[model samples]
Target: MKTVKTHITQLLHAMNMGIFEKEHPIALSLLSAISGESIFFLGPPGVAKSLIARRLKLAFDQSTAFEYLMSRFSTPDEIFGPVSISKLKDEDKYERIIEGYLPSATIVFLDEIWKAGPSIQNSLLTVINEKVYRNGQYTIQLPLKGLIAASNELPAQGEGLEALWDRFLIRYFIGNIEQEFAFDQMIASVNDMEAEIPTGLSITEKQYIDWRTQISQIKIHYTVFELIHSIKRQIEKYNIQKEEVPHSTLYISDRRWKKIVSLLRTSAFLNETDTIRFSDCTLLLHCLWNEIEQIPIIEQMVSSALDECISHYLCGERTLEQKLSSIREDMKSEHSLRETKDPALQIVDTFYHQIERYPVAGNLLIFASDYQSLQKDTQKLFYVQRDKYRPVNWILKVYDHVRNRNISQSAIVSLKKGTRSVFINNQEYPLACNAGYDIAYPQEASLLFEFRFQEVIDLYHNRESE
Candidate 1:
């Protein structure tokens, strides 16, 4: 498995030799080819979209490639093959030559694919999805490892092109090189744009066939399955948010998802992993988006969902926020009982917790408007001391109805040893964690959670570094 991965990695590097900013498309195209799935490239001209497909062909040994620029005038004969006039005259049967056209080729590149005529598009649907071509009464199993299609524009709506568009499992957008140095190198160098894959590195027919079976057996981690479901839920939420807009919903069919999982499994198999890693889920950024605008949204959603699912998987089902809330609820119950037993202890008309140990001579209180914020943000605040007769410079900034102005209240607050404590006027007072609230429930769980959380986090970091 390691040797196979090393060979494929070397092959990918060799294929990307002179190409600038096209490594992703080339890699994805090759992966699609080995998985027996088709990819669609959506980009303008001169971005090397066709070159990506051409380079992918070099990855396969003894592979025939068919390249064509489709137009509305294109007929089935030009795409599939010229009809067998001899067969029609001699045997009174209709059949294509099926010699050097798409059916016989191992790799097919069709540019401006949406412009192809209905006859050509109809035949391509079968060829791409089923890898079978019907020439008269015979069904010819295509030698197609991958069909790469490109177009400057998306297919027009209501044109009966939806089926063909859906046939492409992996859709990617290509663009010109952005970095100045790479662009300079691209123009100054006289190296051939075509990649020269090493003969030993190129995949043979026997290897390709064997890989298909191996790829199917690659394990999909439970986390990856949960991540996919999380992404689907995110897409559903996005669609609901954009419900008013026409055709704004992002939809993935069951079949497309199956192909997507297969592509991920194939990626894992090639990378020498027995199970799909979280990194494999990153590929979904390219596979999920339908419109160009949805790319960034889809990327963000996948990234966020992947991180969230990883955290949940490693640190148990409850999140940090939920754990903290549970602690707060328990504390609130205790506070309510304390107030009920002694009404004099209840600080009415004020939201602050009286702190008795401020080293100064004035009464001090810590603002307790929100318990979580008091615990989380108080330590980061700066404090000032003043004379007993003067108001402290630091103000809590609350409206004073009697004076018709805002006023200040002095307080010293800090979070220490998993407890929130405050000092006012030389006396100590504890707030939420006084009764071992933090230590008893959430803190212990959080300590255990953080250890496992960091392990998974480091795993992702190491994978990225590799």
Candidate 2:
């Protein structure tokens, strides 16, 4: 597995040196090939899509590749081969000369493939989907390791191209580089250095077969399977939701989902792990999205799920480093909050400052005339709104009465008619609308995590001393 990983990595590095900003598409292409599935390059010309495909072919030793650019006028003879004149005349049977065309090749690249006519499209569907090439009375099995198709754009709906489009399984957009450094490096690269095949690192046909057998036996982690199937259900549900709006939905087949597991296994195998890890789940962001807009949404959801798994592991572990790291992050956040201005705190400070300077402060005002004046003054000064000062005035009166009478008070908060009310001694006082709202950071997980973390630290220290 290490050898395979190293050889493929070197091939990608070599290819990407000349091709700027194509790392993702290049990686996806190799993975598609490793899983023995087709992938498509969807973008405008001059993006090194063909270069990446050729580099993939070079990863294997002596793999014959057939590369062609298709067009509306292209025929079967151009893609398959010309008729076998000798066989037709002698045996009176029609067959294509398959020595140098797609049938004879191990790695195939078809550019502008959607422009092919009916004959080419039908034959290609059979060759790619079934791995069988039909010629006259003979149906020959293909030795194709992978097929890479490229187009400037996706096909129109009425063109009857959905089946072919779906067979690619993995689709990637190859775009030109916009970064200054990468573009400059690509342009400055020497034009004469020939690509080395890394013969020593390359795996033979037997080794390739052995790798596939290993992937077949690779054990997928339970969480990995659950994540994939859950996404599949989401795809189905979203398709139903799109019935009214008519947008692109996730339309992956069960066969494709099964094949996706092979890619994950390949990833784990390369990482020298027996079971798939949460890191392997990141690849689903590439596999699950059918449209470019769906890319960020899927990526974010997958990242969140992966982070949840990581937090669970960290919370369970006895590592001093994880604890220190979490504590350090908390300190940084606290420091930021301490320095940043807060609107709620400003409001609270202003409210206390204004209310404390009242002339009636320190006076209970139990007399009828004084009580009326206090009510009118507090209502005008601290009213929550122009027409809704009754609740605010009552709350103030309750506070003054509680303080002056020296009575013990307990508050039970409840919501009444969408307004929060605090009950004290069976008396309900509506809280100010702005006073009851505050934000909570659930990520802190309260003090429970601290107790668990301390226990883990104590256990580790005891183990070490013993």
Candidate 3:
């Protein structure tokens, strides 16, 4: 399993070479291909939508690809292939040649797919859903690994397009490069846009077949099932809230949910995990939204759910509240856990630790809440100066060694519990105990409690970083 994961991960990395801002789409498309599902790309022209499909073909060894631009005037013969006149005339039977068309290809890409004629659309429904093509008298099973469709505009409503639209399990929106540096590199590069995947890394037909069997064996954890149900309820609530706008309502079928779970399972299998994790739920952002406007909303919902789930899981069998309660119980049991009553200066009614090594006018003060926030990322904190042993109104400036300037009033800071250091503007300073400060600096029991509380934070960070 580890070797398979390494191969797939390296293959995906190789496939993403020379591309800009299309990594997510390319990864999802490759995943869909391996899962035996189809994906739809919605974006304007020249956003590398077709290029993604082309690159996907390179992932498979000896795989053939068929690409065509569809229009209302297109007929089945252009897409499915021309009919064999000899068979029609000699035997009075009908069947397509099926030799260089979509049915015979390993990967297929259709551009402007919404404009395809009804005849082509009707045939495509069966091809995408069942992986079989009916060419009059014969139903040939297609060798299709994945079918990728792209369009600048969505299908017209009430035009019998709903059924076909529902067939795509993954719908993604691609846009131009947003980063200035990447965009500059994109326009100035002389390298070929089509990346040449390493031949040794290309997936073989037998390996592909075996992967499908192994993918099904991957387990879906109960937390994943619970998250799905929670997301469904959130969707229902959203529909109720937006009942006035019929188009705003999100309608997902049971079949689509089943397919989504299969995709999650495949992701877990490829990532070398035995069960689905909270990180896999992030993929739902692409699968659940029906309209472009709903994308951000769905993303926020999924992100919030993931955060709560991570917090719960990291705290172990007990909830965060329970864990904190146990910690407080331990604190109460220890008689030496007492606050110092020395006359130390304070700011904003909060006790602060003074810094003499760094040139700062004020005593550095960090609220407990703000200190906890540093476990995730760096934060900017306000420091105030004292006047005649009293808190002053004006915020004091602090020297930022990283930027080589004095940042007015606030310092970018992070906490390093292992070293007992506080990073100010990326410069580390040892946090030493002052003689007369409250909450005895770096008490063994207090540090032990803090470590127990935050040991799982690294797990959450590692998963997200991956």
Candidate 4:
């Protein structure tokens, strides 16, 4: 079970890297594929959305995945193949005709799918919906595991393309990276001479059949169904216009929605679970909502929705347990937050002044060397640098919110082992581990809120110790 799970995780990770250099699409497709259905990749060209489908073909049984780049000129013959000349001659339905572009394949990729003509697109609907295709009164069943289609334009004012769009269950967008980040990765990638593939595991036919059987048997809980329905309601309530609405809604169909839920169940089963949880549904919702037009707002909504589900459904008690863990560590480092007659506030103020005197790196070095202490007396230290701090989960809330366009002027409260609790709009919030919270306004240059926890501290400390 662990082996299969690791393989799936690796497959998804590779597919993500090959796609938008991110992991979400890999996750979406895995779920989509698990349900024995198809997915649509809604993004622009050169994002490697098609590459994702190709990689899946390599991951599973070879010679099973087929691909087609649909064009305005594409014809039904181009996909379904010209009626078997002999079959046409004899008018025999039982003749073994050459498989069309998609019917015989297990995994299929339809690139520029929206551009396909109505006849070709209509032919796909049957394969996607019923895993079968009909050609000249001959119906053929497909041994399809999944199909992935790519498009530049989502469902908007198109030439009656909504029906074709409705065939894909999971829809995702591929976006470009910011200039600076792209430049950084480009440089790093060129310099990394020793990069290597992590594993050699490959999928087999038996694995495929087993996975399908497990997914088929997996059950979805009623609560998850309600959650999905509620998400649909949110979309309809928005009643987004064609121009302003998110593309997510434009691409999916009722059939795809049901398939998506099944995919979620299959994912859970593949992960070695018999029953699908609400967490799985939340993941689906996140992917579904991404198809909407307002990308950022929809992203936030999806994250919030998923977070709420995670906190309430999958690991309700674990959230409290995490807080307790932090508190325990806090108690151990209680000595660090000592009361000094010399005035701790003044000391902190002096430290702040000293930080500003040196260059950013020097400031980080000195502040980290002298003052930072953890709740466990664990020798864990924290500091702020000009560029960025090590990754951590401590929530760094800003005190005295800066309405300034410049982020450097904002005041941020850093969380440490013995750090006092912070309030956000009157609500008490605890610092998390190994995560950073940016408190700067969206346009700001520097991060206002930054958090670092034990592991990050150890990384720096170990290097220093060595």
Candidate 5:
């Protein structure tokens, strides 16, 4: 297992070395291939989309590859090879040679595939979905390991291309390299600097067969299952909301989602692990989104899902933090305070609703109830100088609810014993309630708020029902 993982990982590394800024497309292409799935690249012309697809065959080491550029007029005969004249005339049955077409190839790339007319598109749907192609009298089992498809634009509504579009499991949007990578690549091009293309590391046909069979037996970590369900629920909630995102309803077919487990197993296999890592869920960013705009939304969601897991912790998510910080700045401004309106009320309410709307388990709820409480008090203060909204002790209560929703069972046990924390990479991490600063920091009553956490916990249990 380790040997297989090492070879595959090295092959991925080699593929990445050539592409200037396409780490994700290269990785997903490799993973989709290993899992016997198809991936589609959505981007404009001349973005190395075709280049990445062409270079993928190197990972399989001299595997037979078929590449084609499809157009609006491209025919099935062009892709599947010509029909055998002898079979039609002699046997009176229809059949194509399919010798050098998709069925015989291990790795395939179809550029501008969205341009393919209905005949080719319909034929491809079956070939990609089931690895089987129909030819008049018989269904031929395809040797197709993986396919990488590209389009300058997505499918239009009148084309009847929805079924074929949904068949590609991983929809990745690619573009020109970022400024940093662009400069580097330009320098390399001028100097003719190139990395040696090594091709020895590989997953052979026999190894692929054996490993794929073994992958079915790999136990899925419960966290991975939980993540998948959470994502589905999140998408459901998003679609139901009032916001109008273009093509808001994402339709992942039953077949595609079922096969996702195999993709997860393949991801775990590459890491040489029996259990799926929280990091493995990152690929969901690529797998779930069918639209170009949904990329950012999915990226944040996948990151948030992984963050709250037992294995990973989010220090802060950048974009939301910046938004929060901006809101904070405006709320505290002197000019804003002098006004009759309570700006904090609206801001805090928005944050409160957002927290409830997309509540991620295990993430330290960045906007606390205290923040909400402060805003409430601020509202009272503005009404009259005598009005006060001093926040009292709610730390223990907040901690309890947070721990229930957030902490793993094992870590909760550590908290009960007052283990304080276990160190990771030189930082002391609290097993349960975040110690000192988180509980203590700058509250209206700091000292009292800091202590009595254990007492509160103890008295609540012992005095009533310990």
Candidate 6:
């Protein structure tokens, strides 16, 4: 078993190296191949979707395995075999069956699969689902252990072929790589020019048969049984759209999902684990996430289902949610001060206008002293420049306030004129508005009034909460 697993892993590495990058899809294909079952990869052109399938057949080096790139011109005879000519001549039913294209091959790659006409596809349904073909009066069981089909187009609506889509238990989507890989991909392609296929690393026929036998014997967990039910429930809750209700849903058919878990267990057994562990669920999630619906739903399922298990394996604790909440709370508080500082700003405006109209009026500083005193002080009557343009920053600084907690009340002081600088909460604030050091240092007057207003509001809110 260890030697077989090692050989399979090595074959996977060779198959993966054939593609320039796309390591994730290559890994998925390797897992799908481990089941020794048919897989259909649905992706756009030029993504090396078909190449992965071809590589699998090459890995086995089975000469009897046949591959066909299906086209509009392909007929039923092209796939299942022509009506047996001997029976037609003799009017004997048995000799009339001639094995078609698909039935004759042990491993097949059906390219552009959907383009095959309805009748041809109808013929494939039994061949794929049951591994048997019917022609005339004969039903021929095939040696077909794996069939990897590729299609550029997705399964269509009302095409009346749900059965066909469901047979392809493992479906993969291949997308373009990011911009950073652009130049690296170019260099890799140039180097791969005229690359020859290497041989030696492979899965033997006996090993393949044994793996398939093991796949059948693998016992599924009851928790996984319930988990699959929950998955179906979630899918229904979201009203997810699909080409069909996959056969796995209705037919009690086991999925590549189940097979993947089996393989992970097999891998662990080879590594000498007496019981299959939660880490196997990690690979199960990876395989299922790709084959399932859109990305958001897939991510939510994986995170909710297996994140805890994976975290325990990697870190031994459940801190993902706690860390996220801490970061979120910090962000919310940083921005909450913006919500509270609106009122402080209105008082600042009133002070500016008061300074402009009345300059030093005795107790009012320059309005009382006279026009001469105002002119002597500065050209602008009462300009007050704040050091910080952000009103919330100034409010927080002056109040000496920390979020979610209160500070002791400081006695409110009236704004007083001073040519020397004034300090609020020990930070020197230079006044530069028209009320600069003239009309009671208008900024200080504004802040003191605003502080009293906020104190009253905060008291009411805190009291209400209590």
Q: Rank the candidates by lDDT, best first.
A: 3, 1, 5, 2, 4, 6
Superposed Cα deviation of residue 184, candidate 4 (Å): 6.2
Question: Measured by TM-score, how close is model 4 to the native structure?
Answer: 0.56
lDDT by residue for model 5 over 63-176, one digit each (tens)?
A: 889999998788889899889999899998788998888778989999988888888888898899899998878888988888999988888865688888888888888878
Angstrom error of the Cα, residue 210, model 3: value is 0.9
Over 4 Å off in model 1, which ranges?
191-193, 317-466
lDDT, candidate 1, 312-419, per-residue tens:
565543444455555456556654333221122223224334444444455444334322233332243323333233364222212223221112333323332223
Candidate 3 local lDDT, residue 97? 91
Candidate 1 lDDT (Cα, 0 to 1): 0.72
Write the residue-wise lDDT of candidate 3 on 17-96 in tens digits.
99988889999999999999999999999999988998999999999999999988999999999999999999998988
Clashes of each: 10, 0, 0, 16, 1, 25
Q: Candidate 6, after superposition: displacement of residue 117 in Å?
A: 1.9
What does candidate 6's lDDT look like per residue over 259-283, in tens digits?
5556566545433344455555545
Whole-model lDDT per candidate: 0.72, 0.63, 0.74, 0.54, 0.63, 0.51
Residue-level error in angstroms, candidate 4, position 314: 9.6
Clashing pairs in 2: none
Per-residue lDDT tens digits of candidate 2, residues 1-466? 3565676677677655555687888778777777778888888998887887787787666788999999899989989999999999999999999989999998899999899998898888888878899998999998888899998887766778877777777777778888999888878887834456554555568878888888777777655654664566556676787767654666777777777788788877766678877777678776666667777767765776566546534443535566657655766664533432122211222222112222332311111111112221122221111112222321232122311222233321111111122232233333222444543312221222343344345435422321
Decide which is better by lDDT, 1 or 2. Answer: 1
> Per-prediction TM-score, please?
0.68, 0.64, 0.67, 0.56, 0.64, 0.55
Shift of residue 453 alpha carbon in model 6, Å: 66
Error of 3 at 460 (Å): 21
- C-alpha positional error of residue 75 in candidate 2 after TM-score superposition, expressed in Å: 1.1
